[model samples]
Target: MANIQYVTKEGLDKLRAELDHLESVERPKISQQIAEARDKGDLSENAEYDAAKEAQGLLEMRISKIKDQVANSRVIDASQLDSSKVSILSSVKIKNTANGMEMKYTLVPETEADLSKGKISVNTPIAKGLLGKVVGDIAEVSLPNGMEMKFEILDIKID
Candidate 1:
């Protein structure tokens, strides 16, 4: 079974647009390539045909994976989200307990996660630790470097 993924309405629309592009544009391009390759020579000795077939297989797999992602996706309403605690689509401000460094991150779906924009995926370790934590609560998160860090929730916003 595919894992459920939470996304905003805009994120869902982006996914749908990408899927539509892949189906309407990319799929035909691959089909055309296959057809052109097939017209070149016999199936037994044609390297181009083999390559096109492999490309088509990869394209199909990508399409299927995206389809599954879309199917399991759930849209999160930003306006209805509670700002009392950290959750998906919440923009949280936290301060590191050890270093006293402050940082803000928006917990979003994987598809919408952009490190440059300070958006972190809800499935990430830090975000998971922060989830359900309200202002003034501390969250202890394990990092990839085998170090544990503590962060104090300062603020939470849905928008």
Candidate 2:
């Protein structure tokens, strides 16, 4: 069975838009390249044709993966989620126990995790450890590099 993916409605729309672009725009561009390469004559020495074919293969693979993701993805309703504690779609403010530095992050699905936007994937170590924590709770997260970091939950909201 394929693993079910959870995403926000906005994330699902982005995936659909990407799929449409790949099929309607990129697919035709590759076809045009292939046709132009074919018009150049020699099949065996046609590097352009080979390159276009490779690109087409890669594009098709990407499209397939996105299609699968869209089909399996379930939209998570942020408004319906409880914001009293740290959870997916919750904006959490935490302070590093070691340095006293505070950082805020929103827990989102893997597809929508943009660190620059302060969104962290739910699968991340910090998020995993903070999943059910409330304000004033201490969370110890084990990072992938064999290190652990501790944080104190400062606030939680739905924003």
Candidate 3:
């Protein structure tokens, strides 16, 4: 079964746009390349033709995957999100217990996660631990490196 991904409307639109670009622009370009390569010589040992075919295959795979994601995606309404607890689309401000370091992140789907933008994937360890947590709640998270860390939730807001 394909996993149902929860995404924002903007995220879903981005995926759809990408899929359209791959199918309309990229697919035709690759087809042209394959046709040009085939006109060059025999197909038995044509590296250009082989490369073009491989690229087309990869592009098709990407399109298929994106289509699947689009089909299974459910867009979350930002206005409907609860600000009292950490959840998808919630911007959370947390302080590390050990060093008192503070960080803010918006919990999003994996496809929309951008570390530089302070958007963290919900599947991430810190986000998972923070889920359903309210202000002043302490969340214990186990990192992939086998280290445990504690974060105190300072605030939650729909962003």
Candidate 4:
């Protein structure tokens, strides 16, 4: 069974657009290459034909993978989420208990996570530790480097 992924509406649209481009633009180009190669005769020794067939296989695999992703993706409705507790799509402000440093991050789906934009993946250790927690709660997280850290949840916002 494929894992169900939570995504925003924009992400779904992006996936759809990519799929359309692969089918409409790329598929025909590969077909044309194959046809041109076939006209050269010598079916057993045509490198161009083999290359084009390989390219077509890769393109079909990508299209099928994207189709599966689109089929399993579910859009998260931000307005329907509760702001009182941390969850997917929550913007949380936290303070490091050990160093007195403060940082804010928005917990987003894996596909939408961008560190430069202060968006973290919900599957991350920090985000997982903060899940289902409310403001003023402390979260204890274990990092992949074998280090433990504690962070205080200062605020939670959903938009």
Candidate 5:
């Protein structure tokens, strides 16, 4: 069974647009390449034909996977989200307990995670530790370097 992914309406629209591009633009382009390669003659020894076929297979597989993801996806209503606790789509402000450094991050789905934009994937250790934590609560997270860090939740909001 495929996992049901929770996404925002914008994220779902992006996925749908990407799938549409792959099916309409990419699929037709690959078909044209295969047809051109076939026109070049020999079937068994044509490298162009082989390459095009391989590309077509990869494109189809990607399309299928995206289709499945779209089918299993559920859009999260940000307005309905509660700000009482840290959860997906929550913009949380936290302070490093040890260093006294403060940082703000929004917990988002994997597909929507962009660290440069302060969006962190909910699957990340920090987000996992922060999950279900209310404002003023402390979260202890273990890093990949085997070091433990604590963060104090300063505020929680839906962004």
Candidate 6:
């Protein structure tokens, strides 16, 4: 069974748009290339035809994967989210115990995650450790560097 992925409405729309583009734009482009290649060729020895066929197969696979993702996606209602504890769609502010530096991150679905924008994927180690933590709670998160860092939750917000 495919896993149900949580995403915002915007994220779901983006996926649908990409899938539509792949099906309508990319699919026809590949077909045209294949037809053009076939016009210049004998069946067994045409490198262009072979390459176009291979590219079409890969494009179809990507379209199928995107369709699956769209089918299994669940849109999260931001207004209905609880702010009592850290969770998906929650913007959390924390202070690093080791350096006393404060940072903020918004937990989002993998498709919507952008580190540069202060959004972290829910599946990430730090987000997983921070989930369900409340203000004044200390969380120990294991980093990719093989070191554990301690943080104190300062606030949680839905917006």
Clash totals in order:
0, 0, 0, 0, 0, 0
Specify the poorest-scoring 10-residue window by lDDT in model 6. Answer: 40-49
Model 5: worst 10 consecutive residues (lDDT sum): 77-86
**Candidate 1 wrongly placed segments (more than 4 Å):** none
Residues 21-88 of candidate 4 have per-residue lDDT tens digits of 99999999999999999999997999999999999999999999999999999999999999999999
Query: What TM-score does structure 5 among the candidates reach?
Result: 0.96
> For model 1, what is the alpha-carbon lDDT of residue 58?
91
Q: Candidate 3 residues 57-124, lDDT tens each?
A: 99999999999999999999989878899999999999999999999999999989999999999999
User: What TM-score quantifies how close candidate 1 is to the native fold?
Assistant: 0.91
Give the residue spans of candidate 3 off by over 4 A.
none
Candidate 2 off by > 4 Å: none
Show pairs that collide, candidate 6.
Answer: none
Residue 115 CA error for candidate 1 (Å)? 1.3
- lDDT of candidate 2 over 120-147, digit per residue (tens): 9999999999999999999999999989
lDDT of 5 by residue, 10-115 (tens): 9999999999999999999999999999999998999999999999999999999999999999999988887899999999999999999999999999999999
Question: If ranked by TM-score, best first, what sequence of candidates would result?
Answer: 5, 2, 3, 6, 1, 4
Clash pairs, candidate 5, are: none
**In model 4, what is the error at residue 60, expressed in angstroms?**
0.6
List the RMSD of every prediction in angstroms.
1.6, 1.1, 1.2, 1.6, 1.0, 1.3
Q: Which of 3 and 6 is ahead in TM-score?
A: 3
lDDT agreement of model 6 with the native: 0.95
The RMSD (Cα, Å) of candidate 3 is 1.2
